[model samples]
Target: MAKITLKDLSHSYLKTQSSDADWAVRDVNIDWEDGGAYALLGPSGCGKTTLLNIISGLINPTKGDILFDDKMVSNLNPVERNIAQIFQFPVIYDTMTVYDNLAFPLKNRKIEEDKIKAKVHEIAEMLELSSTLNNRASGLTADGKQKISLGRGLVRSDVNAIMFDEPLTVIDPHLKWILRSKLKELHQKINRTMIYVTHDQTEALTFADQVVVMHEGQIVQTGTPVDLFEKPKHTFVGYFIGSPGMNLLPCEFKGGDVMLNGKKIETHTKVKSNNFSKTEIGVRPEFINFSSEGIPVKVLSVSNTGRHKIVDTQSQSGKIKMIAKTSEDIPSGSAFLSFKKEYTYAYGDDWIIE
Candidate 1:
């Protein structure tokens, strides 16, 4: 295993880059510790795949260096970097049997036949493909074929790191969860450095020890799943990481207080300065409650999502959403909304105020 590092990384596909908008990835610096499970997460076109390809040596950055275990590898090809990359679709040989597909890498390196058999069988068993070892790769289901692709990477012992680029994109919805669980289990069992790239929050949160959230070619935050949900450092992080996301309300900073719709509100952090072009207060729907005496709102609608109710209300300042228990009573017509101060935060220019 190796600790991967990207130093001041920036990439632009254009021959003559004119501005930040021309860059696919920008000023990215990250150290993925040995044996760490990480996910590069964001919406589509957020540079997740570009960064992954750079790490795996598929693309050399236009302006920076990549290192493996502190050794510069910016110019190395994918094979020279000793990394395994599983793409969005399965890349196995269709004519090969399942067993042969898993053993192909080992055979290419001329590993002993007995050792190859042992390793292939081991990975096949872990991926629950042991029963289909003799079947032709073309005959398996999409999920099964993807598992074979995964096993081919895991079967190789010399890989410094394993990178997955939306490996579950072609998988069925129900099987996606099962494959995610399998991947997590494999990571723990093998203890190899793994980088997963995906836009799906559930996949990133469930599979990664650290989620690197990217937005517009820059990393916005890197944190544990709980940290990203509870203390988002950017408004985009707040708006992207959660179901229903966070409610950002336009507000003003007054004399040592935050005022929303002319009502003083408490927040988790104090605004250090009021020099921002835009200012807002961010609080998740899960942290807001209907109170008897707070910011008054006109109840707009309520949606029952089986386990909980999503209440939408229009405060004087803006729309606010709150998650309520199914048993909780939601007032009709009008109600007052209260934000949990410990969970409420102040933001300036889209970044959290320290």
Candidate 2:
């Protein structure tokens, strides 16, 4: 395993990129600790794949350096970097059996035949593919084929890190959860550095210890699942991480107090900024609840999602959403919404105020 570091890394496909919009990945500096599991998460076209490719040495950056354990390795090829990368689609030998497919990487390094067999069996059991060891790769399902690809990467104990790029896209919903859980289990048993790239928030949150959220070719936040949910550094993270997202209401601030639609709303942070172009109060649906007295709103709609109900309301300021428990009461015409003091955040421009 190795501590992967990206120092002032930036990449662009255009030869003479003139603006920030032209770069596929902007300046990003981060250290991925050895034996740590991380996820690069964002929406489509958010440069998640671009950054993954750069780390795996598949694409050279337009600027900056990549270091593995403090060794500058920006110029190294993928093979020279000693990292394994699994792609969105399965990449395996159709003619080979499942056992041979898993053993290929070990065999390439001329490992002893007995050791190769042991490694293959260990990975196959971990992936629940031991029963199909002798089965031909061409005959397996999409999930099975992908498992082989993952096993190929995991079989190599010498790999500095293992990177997966949306590897579960083609998997069924039920199988996707199973595979994600399996991956998490594998990480714990092997304790190797793993980087997963995906747009699915569930996959990212469940699999990674630290998630790196990206937007518009820049990394917005790197934090645990709870950190992203409770305190989003960027408004995009507040809106992107949750199911109903966060409700950002335009407000005015004066003397460490916030005024929303002429009513004072309490927040945990004291935001004092005079030069911001916009000011807003951000609160998650999970934190907002109905109260007899608070901000007045018209109950626009309510959606029952089994476990919880999502209530949409419109105030003079704008639309706001709140998550309610299944047994929680909901008024018909009009109601007052109350935000938890500690959970509420103040924002200047698009970033949360400290």
Candidate 3:
């Protein structure tokens, strides 16, 4: 295993990049500890794949260096880096049997046949493909074929790190959960450095110890799943990481107090009168509740989702959303809203006010 370090990594596909907009990835510096499970998460064009390819040596960065275990590997090819990569789709030969498919990598290195058999069987069993060892790869389902592709990566003991790029996209919804669980289990048993790239928040949160959230060619935040949900450092993070997301209400900072809709409200962070273009208060829907007296709001809509209901309300300042238990009574026409003081945060210029 190797500790991967990205030093001021930036990549631009254009030959003459005139501005930051042309860059695919910019000014990214992060250290992935050895044996750590990490995920690169964001929307479709957020440079997650570009960064992954750079780490795999599939593409070299336009700026900065990549180091593995303290050795500069910016100039090395994928083979020299000794890393295994699984793509979005299965990359396996249809003619080969499941056993041979898993053993191919070991056999390529001229490992002894007995050792290759043992390793192949071990990985096959772990992926729950031991029973289909003799079956041709052409006959397996999509998930099964993908498992074979993953098994090839695991069968090799010499890999320094394993990287997955949206490996579960083609999987069925029910099997996606199963495969994710299996991947987590494999990571625990092997303890190899693994980097997963995906647009799915669930995949990133559940499989990774740390999730690197990227946006518009830049990394916005990197944190545990809990940190991302509880204390979002950026406005985009607050808007992106949740089911109903966070409710951002425009406010003003005056005399050491937060004024929303010309009324004072409490928040955990004190927003000073700074020269910011935007000022707002952020509170998760989970943290907002109905109160007998607070900010008066007009109930717009309520969506029942089994155990809980998402209530949408419009205040004088802006619209807000709150999550409430299904058992609780949701006021019909008019209601008041209260934000838990500890969970409320102040924002300036689209960033948390610290």
Candidate 4:
């Protein structure tokens, strides 16, 4: 295992990049500790894959260096970097049996036959594919083939790091959860440095110790799942990480107070300066509650989702969403809203006011 470091990383596909739009990845610097499980997360076209490819030596950055431990590997190819990559689709030989497929890498390195057998079986049992060891790779289901891809990466002990690029994309909805759980278990058992790239929040939150959230070719935040949800450093992080997401209301900072629709609002963070071009207050839907006396709002809709209700309300300033208990009475037409001050935050120019 190796500690991966990306120093001032930036990648542009164009020959002559003129603007930020020309860059696929921008000014990324991260230190992935040895044996750490991390997820590169974001929406599509947010540079998640580009950054992953760079780390695995599949692509060299236009302007930066990649290091494994202390050695600079910016110019090394994927093979020289000793990286194992699992793709969205399975990349196993169809003619080979499951055992042979897992043992292919070991065989390529001319490992002893007995050791290869032991290692292949070990990975197969962990992935619950022991029963299908003799089956042809062509006969397995999509999930099964994907498991083989994972096993191939695991069987190799010399890999510097194992990187997954949306490895569960083709998996069925129900099976996705199972595969994700299995991946987490494998990471714990092997204790290898693993980097998973995905656009799904659930995958990132559940499997990774740290989630690197990227937006528009830039990393917005790197934190634990709870940290990302509770204390988002950017408005985009607040808007992207949650189910109903956080409610952003336009506000003005005046005399050490936040004014929203002519009403004084409370927030945990104080504005440092009012020099920003845009200013807003951010509070998660989970932090807002209906109150008898607060900001007046018109209840627009209520979506019942079994245990809880997602209430949509329109205030004078903007739309606000709140999560209410299923048993609680939701007032129709007009009601008042209150934000939990401890969970409320002030923002300027899309970044959190610190």
Candidate 5:
């Protein structure tokens, strides 16, 4: 495994463009540690796959350099980078058997036959496909075929890094969990550097040790899963990371108090800004709840998600939602809602305080 460094990386699909919209990927500088597991997470057209391709040597960067273990690999081809890339769909031979598909790569690399047999057996058993080793690849299910693709990628232990590009897009929901858990277990056992690219938040959160959240071709934040959830650096991060996401209400920060819809509430801030334009207050629905002496809101709709009830409401300021444990006595009429200051965050123009 190698420590990957992306130094001043940027890309533009348009040749002669002056504005930011012309760029596909912006100036991104991030250092991924050796043997670290990372996920490139964002919505579509957010440059996750572009960054992945640059790292894999399939596309030459329009600007900047890529370093693998301190060696410049920006201009090198995919083979020279010693990277394994797994795509969304499985690529296999219809004529070959399951055992042959798994053994194909090893055989091409001229690995010993006995070693290939042992390794194939190990991967097959781990993937729960040991019984179907002799089955023709064409007869296998879509999920089974994808498992072979994954096994092929993992079979090569000499690669510098293994990159997965939304490899579970075709798999079923139940199997998705099993595969994700298996990948985590495999990473723990091998300790190889892995970079998984996905637009799905759940997949990224579960599979990555550190997640790099990208938007509109630029990386917004890179932190542990808990860090991304507990304290988002950007408001977009706040809104994009969660299910219903974070509630960001436009407000003004006036010293120790935050003003929203002519209502002032005490908020925590170490230092106040003089020209804090577009100031907003953000709090997760989980942190805000119904209380007697607080801002009032009218209940709109309620959803019972087994564990808790999500109370959707309309307030004087705007819409604000809350998560309640039980639906008992929860009024649909006008009621008051309060935000916990400890869990509250003040933002200036959708940017968090330093």
Candidate 6:
């Protein structure tokens, strides 16, 4: 396995453009530790796939360099980089048998037939395909085909890194969970550097030890799943990570008081009188308490999702929503909200902190 580094990386489609809009991937510098599992997460067209392709060497960047173990490899081809990539859908030979499909990579490299057979059998067993080793791929189910594709990538231990680009899209919702957990288990057993790309937050959080959040061609944040849920560093990050996301209220900052629509709200952070004229106060749904005191809200809708009830409400300031467990009862009419001081974050414009 190798440590991956991206140095001042920015890629644009045009020949020579300097603006941010022209670039597919904006300036980014990050180091992915050796043998670590990482997931690139973001909405569609946010450059997550582009970044993955760049790292895999399927596409070249317009500028900057990529390094594997401190050696520059931005120009290397996919095969020369020693990277194994699994696509969104299964990429196996339908005409070939499951065993042959898994054996293709090893045979292509002129490895000994006995060794290839042993390795293929081992990977097939790991994928639970040992019983169907001789089964033709054309007759297998989608999930079975995908398993073959996964086995193909994992059959070789000489690969520098294994990359996956939304490899669970075609999978059934229930099977997706099982496959994700299995992938995590496999990662632990093999200890290979793996980078996965996905737009789904649940998939990203469950599979990767670290997640890289991208927005509009730039990486907004990189952190553990818990770090992102509890403390988001950007307004977009706050608006994107959670189920209902976070509540953002524009406020006036002066001294220790946070003025919202001329009313001062209590805060955990110390603020100077003239520090920042205006900023945004962000709090998660879990941090906002629906109490008898504080700002009042009108309940627009309430949805019971088994374990919790997601309450959609509207306040004088703007739209506000909160989640309450099914066991907890919400007070009827003009429900009040109490913000958790310690859990709140202060932001200047869209960026958090100061």
lDDT of 5 by residue, 1-354 (tens): 789999999988777769887878889999999888999999998888889999999888789999988989898998778888889888888999999999988998899999999999998988888999999998988889988988887777788889999999999889888888988998998899999999899999999999999988888899999988878878888989987788888876666577888788655453367477688888888888788878888999999898888889998778898888875557879998888876678888777765
Global CA lDDT of candidate 1, please? 0.93
Clashes of 5: 0
Off by over 4 Å in 3: none
TM-scores for every predicted model:
0.96, 0.94, 0.94, 0.96, 0.91, 0.92
Per-residue lDDT of candidate 6, residues 1-354 (tens digit): 789999989887789886788888999889999889999999999998889889989889887889999999987998788888889999889789999999998898899999999999899889999999998987887788888888989998888888988999999998998899989999999999999999999899999999999998999899999988888888888989998899988887766667777777776665554444458888888788887778878888888989789888888778877888888887766788888887788777677773
Cα lDDT tens digits, model 3, 1-354, are 789999999999999899989999999999999999999999998899999999999998999999998899999998789899999998888899988899988887889999999999899889999999999998999899999989999998878899999999899999999999999999999999999999988889999999999988888889999999999888888888999888998898887788888888898877766777898899999998899999999999999999799999999988999999999899999999999998899888888887
Minimal lDDT window, size 10, model 5: 265-274
Q: Which regions in candidate 5 have their CA more than 4 angstroms from the true location?
A: 107-115, 255-257, 268-271, 274-277
lDDT string, candidate 1, 209-285, tens digits: 99999999999999999999999999999999998999999999987689997889999977778888999999999
* Candidate 2 ranges with C-alpha deviation above 4 Å: none
Question: Which sections of candidate 6 miss by over 4 Å?
Answer: 255-257, 268-278
The candidate with the higher lDDT, 1 or 3, is 1
**Tens digit per residue, CA lDDT, model 2, 28-141:** 999999999999999999899999999999999999999999999999998889899999998989899999999998888899999999999998998899999999998999
Span of ten consecutive residues with least summed lDDT in model 4:
268-277
lDDT score of residue 292 within candidate 1? 80
Clashing pairs in 2: none
RMSD of 6: 2.2
| lDDT at residue 126 of model 3 (Cα atoms) | 91
